[model samples]
Target: MAAWGSTLWLLLHWQVDLKSVLIYLAVLLMMHLYTGLFITAHDAMHGVVAPGNKKLNTFIGTVTAGLFAYNYYGRLYPKHHQHHRHVATDQDPDYHGGNFFLWFLSFARQYITVWQILLMAGTYHLLQHWFPLENIILFWMLPAVLATFQLFYFGTYLPHRGEHEPGNRHRSGTQRRNHVWAFLSCYFFGYHYEHHDKPYLPWWKLYQEKDRLLKENERV
Candidate 1:
């Protein structure tokens, strides 16, 4: 949360300099941090953030999810569990075996509630009064939009797309072994089969799980 809040605060106050590469870099950084917000929420939903304290866990999840464009935790929690239960089947809220754009649309339709839109519109109006409009658009708004694509492409589409290994219970595929790239891409969520195999592990520990799985495969 500190990382996200600090980055956003810096960006919102930064002077506009479109010609500078630093501005672009900052936008990308904000985008990644925005992705972190959602991933943190995802972790909270899994009870990884504050195990043994259900209220604390739910509070953290609710806050992070709300930060990510006013998403409702109560709405997402059930759907996420449904995704786990139904997986790649038609019943899975996250699944779409067809085209990427089509699937993204389908996925967006499920979560993009009217309240979220109204809240965002209202927040945009309110923030613009306090922050530069361009900063609000470029840093705050743009990053959140980009972060959705990051989450969908690396975390959802790539991991669950197309055919899976025969008899794979998770119906998931992992990225090639490259922990650094995996982290940069989507917080190591591209090591996705490792995730479904061990949902209890937080995003930070996915690389360790990946390493263990790779070593196990090597010895086979």
Candidate 2:
């Protein structure tokens, strides 16, 4: 549904000249929708919108990712779950890297890769061309490929590490910075620690939960 809306908007504005610098900015803006879709699918996968219905959640997640040509829930959910249980501990695969400086320096080296993007794009194209619909290649597949690169850079790279609170008791500045990036790029995924603590909360409700939890903790 969201994808359809973005596609329509994109096509409606197709006559706009792509030669100017603003054209590049427009493309960048359109790509943000992909980030939103990814976060939506992530919340849906955790059954945050409707809990206890694993099949329904997985189905929705797969379809959402299919629209974007990426499947983090399918491929990365288990690892994410492990990260949740372990939190900021070294046992958390999501946070198992070196100190903040080293992690920040290796951000591009760690996650972004041309080969991974190409493989994802190629897989999407092959599936669209050989499977039921050829038009999907031009529509969803291509947009997804463009969006994936944006997702990699904005979603994964910057937020890999950072502290959220002062004194480094809970989240590092790097993680907090990541949260801000995720929030801007992917609709509030920057509140990642909150989400990890309560995966069953919807994206819209996450800030509320964080507020509630923080207040409760402060009282303690």
Candidate 3:
């Protein structure tokens, strides 16, 4: 969250040429920032953050989720819990055992509530006079949309689906075990097996746990 705010601060005060046609590069950075923020909210939903304090945890989750694109954490919590409890099954709203694009569209549609769109449209309407329309679309709106794809692909579809070795606890799969790439890709969520086995641990801790588990396996 701090990094996200810092990026916004830089964008606001850095005096970049927003009118330039090449401002789309900043869109990539914004996409990443949005993805990171959503990942934080995802962690909170898993009860891996502030486990003892329900109010504080939900507060943090709601703020991050809303900032990503006006998501209500309270609404998301029940749905997310259902996903965890019945992952890769018909009950999991995120899982679609059909075509990739079709499944993705369905998954995204489930989370993209009507109120979210109204909130964003209303926000953009109010900010139009103050912020450049192009900047708002490219930096704010486009990135939020792209970030959904990034989160869905890396954090959900890839880790939970695709070709993978059969993990013991859950049927989830881990990506290539490069710590940097794992963190960069999905905030260490590529270690999906570790995550399912230790749902109480935050994303950052998954890397260390992955290594320790591998060492134990080697010893065996």
The lDDT values for all models are 0.92, 0.56, 0.82
Ordered from best to worst lDDT, the candidate numbers read 1, 3, 2
Clashing pairs in 3: none
Better of 1 and 2 by lDDT: 1
The per-residue C-alpha lDDT of model 2 at residue 65 equals: 59
Q: Please provide the root mean square deviation of candidate 3 (C-alpha atoms, Å).
A: 2.4
**Model 3 alpha-carbon drift over 4 Å, by segment:** 12-25, 162-167
For residues 127-196, what per-residue lDDT tens digits would candidate 3 score against the true structure?
7777666667777788889988888888788867754465454768877679998877778888888888
Count of clashes, each model: 0, 13, 0
lDDT for position 37 in model 1: 85
Instruction: Give per-model TM-scores.
Output: 0.98, 0.61, 0.90
lDDT assessment of candidate 3: 0.82
Worst 10 residues of 1 by lDDT: 36-45
For candidate 3, the TM-score is 0.90
lDDT of 2 by residue, 94-183 (tens): 453576445444533443457557767686667554443423433445456566655544444444454445553434222333334545
